[model samples]
Target: MGYLTCKFVRPDKQLFEGKCASMTLVTYSGELGVLPGHASEICALGDGVVRIKRLDEDGGDERDVVVSGGYAEICNDVVVIIADHARAADDIDAETVRRTHDKAQAKRDALPEGDHQRAYYENKMAWCDLLLEKAGAQTASE
Candidate 1:
Protein backbone atom coordinates (compact mmCIF):
# COMPACT_ATOMS: atom_id res chain seq x y z
CA MET A 1 0.00 0.00 0.00
CA GLY A 2 1.01 3.62 -0.52
CA TYR A 3 -0.04 6.96 0.84
CA LEU A 4 -3.22 8.32 -0.74
CA THR A 5 -3.67 12.04 -1.08
CA CYS A 6 -7.11 13.25 -0.06
CA LYS A 7 -8.65 16.58 -0.91
CA PHE A 8 -12.15 17.55 0.13
CA VAL A 9 -13.71 20.65 -1.44
CA ARG A 10 -16.87 22.51 -0.62
CA PRO A 11 -19.23 24.36 -2.96
CA ASP A 12 -17.62 27.68 -2.05
CA LYS A 13 -14.28 26.16 -3.14
CA GLN A 14 -12.90 25.75 0.35
CA LEU A 15 -10.47 22.84 0.48
CA PHE A 16 -9.26 20.50 3.17
CA GLU A 17 -6.06 18.70 2.32
CA GLY A 18 -4.76 15.63 4.03
CA LYS A 19 -3.21 12.22 3.52
CA CYS A 20 -4.71 8.89 4.38
CA ALA A 21 -3.82 5.27 4.03
CA SER A 22 -7.38 4.52 3.00
CA MET A 23 -10.80 6.16 2.90
CA THR A 24 -14.40 5.07 2.87
CA LEU A 25 -17.25 7.14 1.40
CA VAL A 26 -20.96 6.61 1.66
CA THR A 27 -23.05 7.09 -1.45
CA TYR A 28 -26.71 6.80 -2.29
CA SER A 29 -26.09 3.43 -3.93
CA GLY A 30 -23.66 2.06 -1.34
CA GLU A 31 -20.33 2.48 0.38
CA LEU A 32 -17.05 2.54 -1.50
CA GLY A 33 -13.57 2.16 -0.12
CA VAL A 34 -10.49 3.52 -1.77
CA LEU A 35 -7.00 2.22 -1.39
CA PRO A 36 -3.78 2.70 -3.19
CA GLY A 37 -3.90 1.56 -6.82
CA HIS A 38 -7.66 1.35 -7.00
CA ALA A 39 -9.32 1.72 -10.37
CA SER A 40 -10.39 5.14 -11.56
CA GLU A 41 -14.05 5.81 -10.91
CA ILE A 42 -16.60 8.45 -9.91
CA CYS A 43 -19.22 8.22 -7.19
CA ALA A 44 -22.29 10.23 -6.36
CA LEU A 45 -22.02 10.64 -2.62
CA GLY A 46 -25.15 11.08 -0.56
CA ASP A 47 -25.56 12.88 2.73
CA GLY A 48 -23.54 11.00 5.33
CA VAL A 49 -20.31 10.69 7.16
CA VAL A 50 -17.11 10.58 5.14
CA ARG A 51 -14.41 8.87 7.17
CA ILE A 52 -10.74 9.40 6.54
CA LYS A 53 -7.80 7.83 8.30
CA ARG A 54 -5.13 10.47 8.31
CA LEU A 55 -1.46 9.60 8.34
CA ASP A 56 -0.08 10.48 11.77
CA GLU A 57 3.10 12.46 11.70
CA ASP A 58 3.93 12.23 15.40
CA GLY A 59 2.08 9.22 16.71
CA GLY A 60 -1.60 9.39 15.84
CA ASP A 61 -3.86 11.91 14.17
CA GLU A 62 -7.62 11.46 14.15
CA ARG A 63 -10.25 13.39 12.21
CA ASP A 64 -13.69 13.00 10.68
CA VAL A 65 -15.99 15.13 8.52
CA VAL A 66 -19.66 15.09 7.68
CA VAL A 67 -20.54 15.86 4.09
CA SER A 68 -24.03 17.10 3.32
CA GLY A 69 -23.78 15.76 -0.25
CA GLY A 70 -21.18 15.53 -2.95
CA TYR A 71 -19.37 13.54 -5.58
CA ALA A 72 -16.15 11.67 -5.15
CA GLU A 73 -13.62 10.63 -7.73
CA ILE A 74 -10.66 8.35 -7.48
CA CYS A 75 -7.94 8.38 -10.09
CA ASN A 76 -4.23 8.08 -10.28
CA ASP A 77 -2.95 8.60 -6.72
CA VAL A 78 -5.50 11.07 -5.48
CA VAL A 79 -9.00 11.03 -4.05
CA VAL A 80 -11.04 14.12 -4.81
CA ILE A 81 -14.24 14.99 -3.00
CA ILE A 82 -16.44 17.77 -4.31
CA ALA A 83 -19.05 18.40 -1.65
CA ASP A 84 -22.12 20.56 -1.78
CA HIS A 85 -21.62 21.12 1.92
CA ALA A 86 -19.01 19.90 4.38
CA ARG A 87 -17.90 20.62 7.92
CA ALA A 88 -15.24 19.18 10.13
CA ALA A 89 -16.23 17.55 13.38
CA ASP A 90 -14.94 20.44 15.45
CA ASP A 91 -16.47 23.03 13.21
CA ILE A 92 -20.10 22.01 13.47
CA ASP A 93 -22.33 24.27 15.53
CA ALA A 94 -24.85 22.62 17.83
CA GLU A 95 -27.67 25.16 17.51
CA THR A 96 -27.46 25.23 13.73
CA VAL A 97 -27.42 21.47 13.54
CA ARG A 98 -30.53 21.24 15.67
CA ARG A 99 -32.32 23.75 13.49
CA THR A 100 -31.31 21.93 10.34
CA HIS A 101 -32.50 18.62 11.72
CA ASP A 102 -35.82 20.14 12.68
CA LYS A 103 -36.24 21.61 9.21
CA ALA A 104 -35.48 18.28 7.55
CA GLN A 105 -37.96 16.55 9.80
CA ALA A 106 -40.61 19.06 8.84
CA LYS A 107 -39.97 18.54 5.16
CA ARG A 108 -40.10 14.81 5.64
CA ASP A 109 -43.49 15.07 7.27
CA ALA A 110 -44.87 17.27 4.52
CA LEU A 111 -43.50 15.13 1.69
CA PRO A 112 -46.00 13.08 -0.33
CA GLU A 113 -45.87 9.33 -0.84
CA GLY A 114 -43.28 8.43 -3.43
CA ASP A 115 -39.78 7.09 -3.77
CA HIS A 116 -38.43 10.46 -4.81
CA GLN A 117 -39.63 12.36 -1.77
CA ARG A 118 -38.79 9.43 0.44
CA ALA A 119 -35.26 9.36 -0.88
CA TYR A 120 -34.95 13.10 -0.59
CA TYR A 121 -35.95 13.16 3.05
CA GLU A 122 -33.85 10.11 3.70
CA ASN A 123 -30.79 11.89 2.41
CA LYS A 124 -31.60 15.10 4.27
CA MET A 125 -32.20 13.17 7.42
CA ALA A 126 -28.95 11.39 6.92
CA TRP A 127 -27.12 14.71 6.68
CA CYS A 128 -28.74 16.06 9.82
CA ASP A 129 -28.13 12.83 11.66
CA LEU A 130 -24.48 12.82 10.74
CA LEU A 131 -24.13 16.46 11.70
CA LEU A 132 -25.68 15.95 15.08
CA GLU A 133 -23.65 12.84 15.66
CA LYS A 134 -20.40 14.53 14.78
CA ALA A 135 -21.40 17.59 16.76
CA GLY A 136 -21.95 15.49 19.89
CA ALA A 137 -25.64 16.29 20.13
CA GLN A 138 -27.42 13.51 22.02
CA THR A 139 -30.95 13.90 20.66
CA ALA A 140 -30.25 13.66 16.95
CA SER A 141 -32.94 12.19 14.72
CA GLU A 142 -32.55 8.78 13.10
Candidate 2:
Protein backbone atom coordinates (compact mmCIF):
# COMPACT_ATOMS: atom_id res chain seq x y z
CA MET A 1 0.00 0.00 0.00
CA GLY A 2 1.12 3.53 -0.77
CA TYR A 3 1.69 6.03 2.03
CA LEU A 4 1.54 9.79 2.39
CA THR A 5 4.09 11.93 4.13
CA CYS A 6 2.28 13.75 6.95
CA LYS A 7 3.34 16.56 9.20
CA PHE A 8 1.33 18.02 12.07
CA VAL A 9 2.46 21.35 13.46
CA ARG A 10 1.39 23.85 16.05
CA PRO A 11 2.57 27.39 16.77
CA ASP A 12 4.78 26.15 19.59
CA LYS A 13 6.15 23.02 17.88
CA GLN A 14 5.61 20.19 15.47
CA LEU A 15 3.58 17.39 16.98
CA PHE A 16 4.04 14.69 14.36
CA GLU A 17 5.96 14.08 11.15
CA GLY A 18 5.84 10.69 9.49
CA LYS A 19 4.41 8.50 6.78
CA CYS A 20 0.77 7.52 7.18
CA ALA A 21 -1.52 5.22 5.27
CA SER A 22 -4.54 7.45 5.92
CA MET A 23 -5.72 10.46 7.88
CA THR A 24 -9.15 11.60 8.94
CA LEU A 25 -9.89 15.04 10.31
CA VAL A 26 -12.68 17.50 10.85
CA THR A 27 -12.96 20.61 8.68
CA TYR A 28 -15.41 23.44 8.39
CA SER A 29 -17.21 21.43 5.71
CA GLY A 30 -17.17 18.33 7.95
CA GLU A 31 -15.06 15.17 8.14
CA LEU A 32 -12.46 14.51 5.44
CA GLY A 33 -10.43 11.37 4.75
CA VAL A 34 -7.14 11.52 2.90
CA LEU A 35 -5.10 8.74 1.38
CA PRO A 36 -2.07 8.45 -0.86
CA GLY A 37 -2.42 10.30 -4.16
CA HIS A 38 -5.33 12.40 -2.96
CA ALA A 39 -5.97 15.58 -4.92
CA SER A 40 -4.08 18.57 -3.66
CA GLU A 41 -6.16 21.08 -1.72
CA ILE A 42 -6.37 23.19 1.41
CA CYS A 43 -9.01 23.00 4.10
CA ALA A 44 -10.09 25.05 7.10
CA LEU A 45 -9.97 22.69 10.07
CA GLY A 46 -12.48 22.62 12.88
CA ASP A 47 -12.14 21.74 16.56
CA GLY A 48 -12.00 17.94 16.78
CA VAL A 49 -9.83 14.85 16.68
CA VAL A 50 -7.36 14.11 13.88
CA ARG A 51 -6.83 10.38 13.32
CA ILE A 52 -3.68 9.20 11.59
CA LYS A 53 -3.15 5.60 10.60
CA ARG A 54 0.54 4.80 10.30
CA LEU A 55 1.92 3.05 7.26
CA ASP A 56 3.27 -0.52 7.27
CA GLU A 57 1.62 -1.36 10.53
CA ASP A 58 -1.42 -3.14 11.89
CA GLY A 59 -4.77 -1.37 11.68
CA GLY A 60 -4.58 -0.70 15.40
CA ASP A 61 -1.50 1.48 14.97
CA GLU A 62 -3.19 4.86 14.86
CA ARG A 63 -2.63 8.20 16.47
CA ASP A 64 -5.32 10.62 17.55
CA VAL A 65 -4.58 14.30 17.86
CA VAL A 66 -6.88 16.93 19.31
CA VAL A 67 -6.86 20.04 17.16
CA SER A 68 -8.68 23.17 18.22
CA GLY A 69 -8.55 25.02 14.93
CA GLY A 70 -6.27 25.54 11.98
CA TYR A 71 -5.73 24.49 8.38
CA ALA A 72 -4.54 21.48 6.42
CA GLU A 73 -2.83 21.44 3.07
CA ILE A 74 -2.30 18.44 0.83
CA CYS A 75 -0.10 18.22 -2.22
CA ASN A 76 2.00 15.65 -3.99
CA ASP A 77 1.22 12.94 -1.46
CA VAL A 78 2.26 15.15 1.42
CA VAL A 79 -0.10 16.55 4.04
CA VAL A 80 0.74 19.36 6.42
CA ILE A 81 -1.55 20.29 9.28
CA ILE A 82 -0.95 23.60 11.00
CA ALA A 83 -3.21 23.98 13.97
CA ASP A 84 -3.89 26.69 16.53
CA HIS A 85 -3.47 24.05 19.21
CA ALA A 86 -2.70 20.36 18.79
CA ARG A 87 -1.80 17.52 21.15
CA ALA A 88 -1.56 13.79 20.89
CA ALA A 89 -4.20 11.82 22.78
CA ASP A 90 -1.70 10.09 25.01
CA ASP A 91 0.02 13.39 25.85
CA ILE A 92 -3.05 15.13 27.17
CA ASP A 93 -3.83 15.50 30.87
CA ALA A 94 -7.44 14.72 31.54
CA GLU A 95 -7.54 16.54 34.87
CA THR A 96 -6.12 19.70 33.35
CA VAL A 97 -8.60 19.57 30.51
CA ARG A 98 -11.47 19.11 32.93
CA ARG A 99 -10.36 22.08 35.01
CA THR A 100 -10.05 24.23 31.92
CA HIS A 101 -13.48 23.18 30.79
CA ASP A 102 -14.94 24.07 34.14
CA LYS A 103 -13.24 27.45 34.22
CA ALA A 104 -14.31 28.30 30.69
CA GLN A 105 -17.85 27.24 31.41
CA ALA A 106 -17.97 29.43 34.49
CA LYS A 107 -16.60 32.42 32.59
CA ARG A 108 -19.03 31.90 29.74
CA ASP A 109 -21.92 31.80 32.14
CA ALA A 110 -20.81 35.04 33.79
CA LEU A 111 -20.68 36.88 30.48
CA PRO A 112 -23.77 38.62 29.21
CA GLU A 113 -25.83 36.98 26.51
CA GLY A 114 -24.62 39.37 23.79
CA ASP A 115 -21.00 39.49 24.93
CA HIS A 116 -18.50 38.32 22.31
CA GLN A 117 -16.23 36.96 25.03
CA ARG A 118 -18.90 34.39 25.74
CA ALA A 119 -18.26 32.78 22.39
CA TYR A 120 -14.55 32.56 23.04
CA TYR A 121 -15.10 30.85 26.37
CA GLU A 122 -17.69 28.59 24.84
CA ASN A 123 -15.29 27.55 22.14
CA LYS A 124 -12.64 26.89 24.73
CA MET A 125 -15.00 24.71 26.68
CA ALA A 126 -15.87 22.74 23.57
CA TRP A 127 -12.21 22.27 22.74
CA CYS A 128 -11.57 20.94 26.19
CA ASP A 129 -14.42 18.51 25.79
CA LEU A 130 -12.90 17.24 22.58
CA LEU A 131 -9.60 16.70 24.33
CA LEU A 132 -11.28 14.80 27.13
CA GLU A 133 -13.20 12.67 24.68
CA LYS A 134 -10.08 11.81 22.74
CA ALA A 135 -8.25 10.94 25.90
CA GLY A 136 -11.05 8.69 27.04
CA ALA A 137 -11.20 6.91 23.73
CA GLN A 138 -7.50 6.29 23.78
CA THR A 139 -7.64 4.95 27.31
CA ALA A 140 -10.49 2.59 26.50
CA SER A 141 -8.69 1.26 23.44
CA GLU A 142 -5.61 0.44 25.46
Candidate 3:
Protein backbone atom coordinates (compact mmCIF):
# COMPACT_ATOMS: atom_id res chain seq x y z
CA MET A 1 0.00 0.00 0.00
CA GLY A 2 1.11 3.53 -0.61
CA TYR A 3 1.67 6.08 2.18
CA LEU A 4 -0.26 9.24 2.87
CA THR A 5 1.37 12.48 3.91
CA CYS A 6 -0.34 13.70 7.03
CA LYS A 7 -0.22 16.91 8.96
CA PHE A 8 -2.01 17.50 12.23
CA VAL A 9 -1.72 21.02 13.50
CA ARG A 10 -3.03 23.56 15.97
CA PRO A 11 -2.68 27.33 16.13
CA ASP A 12 0.15 26.99 18.60
CA LYS A 13 2.18 24.25 16.98
CA GLN A 14 2.37 21.45 14.47
CA LEU A 15 1.57 18.26 16.34
CA PHE A 16 2.63 15.94 13.56
CA GLU A 17 3.94 16.01 9.99
CA GLY A 18 4.98 12.95 8.10
CA LYS A 19 3.81 9.99 6.11
CA CYS A 20 1.53 7.34 7.55
CA ALA A 21 -0.07 4.14 6.44
CA SER A 22 -3.45 5.25 7.70
CA MET A 23 -5.36 7.43 10.14
CA THR A 24 -8.71 7.52 11.81
CA LEU A 25 -10.26 10.86 12.62
CA VAL A 26 -13.18 11.48 14.90
CA THR A 27 -15.47 14.06 13.36
CA TYR A 28 -18.93 15.43 13.91
CA SER A 29 -20.35 12.69 11.74
CA GLY A 30 -18.15 10.00 13.33
CA GLU A 31 -14.82 8.35 12.89
CA LEU A 32 -13.46 8.53 9.34
CA GLY A 33 -10.50 6.51 8.28
CA VAL A 34 -8.11 7.71 5.57
CA LEU A 35 -5.48 5.78 3.69
CA PRO A 36 -3.14 6.45 0.87
CA GLY A 37 -4.86 7.50 -2.36
CA HIS A 38 -8.09 8.06 -0.48
CA ALA A 39 -10.69 10.20 -2.14
CA SER A 40 -10.31 13.94 -1.63
CA GLU A 41 -12.75 15.48 0.79
CA ILE A 42 -13.27 17.81 3.70
CA CYS A 43 -15.23 17.44 6.90
CA ALA A 44 -16.12 19.22 10.10
CA LEU A 45 -14.05 18.13 13.07
CA GLY A 46 -15.13 17.57 16.63
CA ASP A 47 -13.76 16.71 20.02
CA GLY A 48 -12.06 13.34 19.67
CA VAL A 49 -8.96 11.39 18.81
CA VAL A 50 -6.83 11.07 15.66
CA ARG A 51 -4.85 7.87 15.28
CA ILE A 52 -2.02 7.91 12.76
CA LYS A 53 -0.07 4.77 11.98
CA ARG A 54 3.38 4.98 10.46
CA LEU A 55 4.40 2.34 7.98
CA ASP A 56 8.02 3.00 7.20
CA GLU A 57 10.76 1.62 9.37
CA ASP A 58 12.82 4.79 9.25
CA GLY A 59 9.91 7.06 10.18
CA GLY A 60 9.15 7.98 13.77
CA ASP A 61 6.49 6.47 15.94
CA GLU A 62 2.76 6.56 15.22
CA ARG A 63 0.71 9.22 16.98
CA ASP A 64 -2.65 9.60 18.60
CA VAL A 65 -3.85 13.19 18.88
CA VAL A 66 -6.87 14.58 20.67
CA VAL A 67 -8.32 17.54 18.84
CA SER A 68 -11.35 19.77 19.07
CA GLY A 69 -12.92 22.39 16.84
CA GLY A 70 -11.76 22.66 13.25
CA TYR A 71 -11.69 20.89 9.92
CA ALA A 72 -9.87 18.09 8.18
CA GLU A 73 -8.92 17.94 4.56
CA ILE A 74 -7.75 15.17 2.32
CA CYS A 75 -6.46 15.73 -1.18
CA ASN A 76 -3.91 14.27 -3.49
CA ASP A 77 -2.79 11.66 -1.01
CA VAL A 78 -2.30 14.24 1.73
CA VAL A 79 -4.31 14.59 4.88
CA VAL A 80 -4.39 17.86 6.78
CA ILE A 81 -6.05 18.58 10.05
CA ILE A 82 -6.29 22.18 11.10
CA ALA A 83 -7.60 22.02 14.61
CA ASP A 84 -8.57 24.90 16.83
CA HIS A 85 -6.97 23.07 19.70
CA ALA A 86 -5.05 19.80 19.85
CA ARG A 87 -2.68 17.75 21.96
CA ALA A 88 -0.96 14.45 21.70
CA ALA A 89 -2.69 11.72 23.68
CA ASP A 90 0.33 11.36 25.92
CA ASP A 91 0.19 15.07 26.72
CA ILE A 92 -3.33 15.16 28.08
CA ASP A 93 -3.56 16.13 31.74
CA ALA A 94 -6.35 14.20 33.37
CA GLU A 95 -6.32 16.20 36.58
CA THR A 96 -6.63 19.47 34.72
CA VAL A 97 -9.45 18.14 32.63
CA ARG A 98 -11.24 16.86 35.71
CA ARG A 99 -10.94 20.26 37.33
CA THR A 100 -12.27 21.94 34.21
CA HIS A 101 -15.08 19.44 34.06
CA ASP A 102 -15.96 20.19 37.67
CA LYS A 103 -16.08 23.89 36.98
CA ALA A 104 -18.26 23.49 33.90
CA GLN A 105 -20.46 21.04 35.72
CA ALA A 106 -21.00 23.49 38.52
CA LYS A 107 -21.97 26.20 36.07
CA ARG A 108 -24.21 23.86 34.17
CA ASP A 109 -25.92 22.57 37.28
CA ALA A 110 -26.71 26.08 38.43
CA LEU A 111 -28.77 26.67 35.33
CA PRO A 112 -32.16 25.14 34.68
CA GLU A 113 -32.63 22.73 31.81
CA GLY A 114 -32.78 24.20 28.33
CA ASP A 115 -31.01 27.34 29.45
CA HIS A 116 -28.90 28.77 26.63
CA GLN A 117 -25.93 29.42 28.90
CA ARG A 118 -26.09 25.90 30.17
CA ALA A 119 -25.36 24.64 26.70
CA TYR A 120 -21.94 26.27 26.73
CA TYR A 121 -21.10 24.75 30.08
CA GLU A 122 -22.36 21.40 28.95
CA ASN A 123 -20.17 21.51 25.89
CA LYS A 124 -17.15 22.41 27.98
CA MET A 125 -17.82 19.59 30.34
CA ALA A 126 -18.23 17.23 27.45
CA TRP A 127 -14.88 18.22 26.00
CA CYS A 128 -13.24 17.85 29.37
CA ASP A 129 -14.87 14.51 29.84
CA LEU A 130 -13.57 13.35 26.49
CA LEU A 131 -10.05 14.41 27.39
CA LEU A 132 -10.16 12.75 30.78
CA GLU A 133 -11.54 9.61 29.22
CA LYS A 134 -8.69 9.47 26.74
CA ALA A 135 -6.31 10.04 29.60
CA GLY A 136 -7.67 6.85 31.11
CA ALA A 137 -9.44 8.33 34.11
CA GLN A 138 -12.45 10.38 35.17
CA THR A 139 -13.78 12.84 37.74
CA ALA A 140 -12.52 12.37 41.26
CA SER A 141 -15.94 11.23 42.31
CA GLU A 142 -15.92 8.42 39.77
Query: Which candidate tops lDDT?
Result: 2
Runs of candidate 3 exceeding 4 Å displacement = 59-61, 107-117, 137-142
Candidate 3 lDDT over residue span 1-142, tens digit each? 7898888889988988988889998899899999888899999898888889888775746678888889999999999899987878888788788988999899899989988999899878877877877788423424
Candidate 3: worst-modelled 10 consecutive residues by lDDT: 133-142
In terms of lDDT, model 2 sits at 0.89
List, residue by residue over 23-115, the lDDT tens digit for candidate 2. Answer: 998898789999988999999999788899987665548888888889999999999999998888889999999999999999899988999
- Candidate 1 regions with alpha-carbon error over 4 angstroms: 99-130, 137-142
Model 1, span 4-71: residue lDDT tens? 88889997875578678778888998778788898999999887777787766623465567776779
Q: By descending TM-score, how would the candidates be arranged?
A: 2, 3, 1
List TM-score per model, in order: 0.70, 0.82, 0.77
**TM-score of the candidate numbered 3?**
0.77
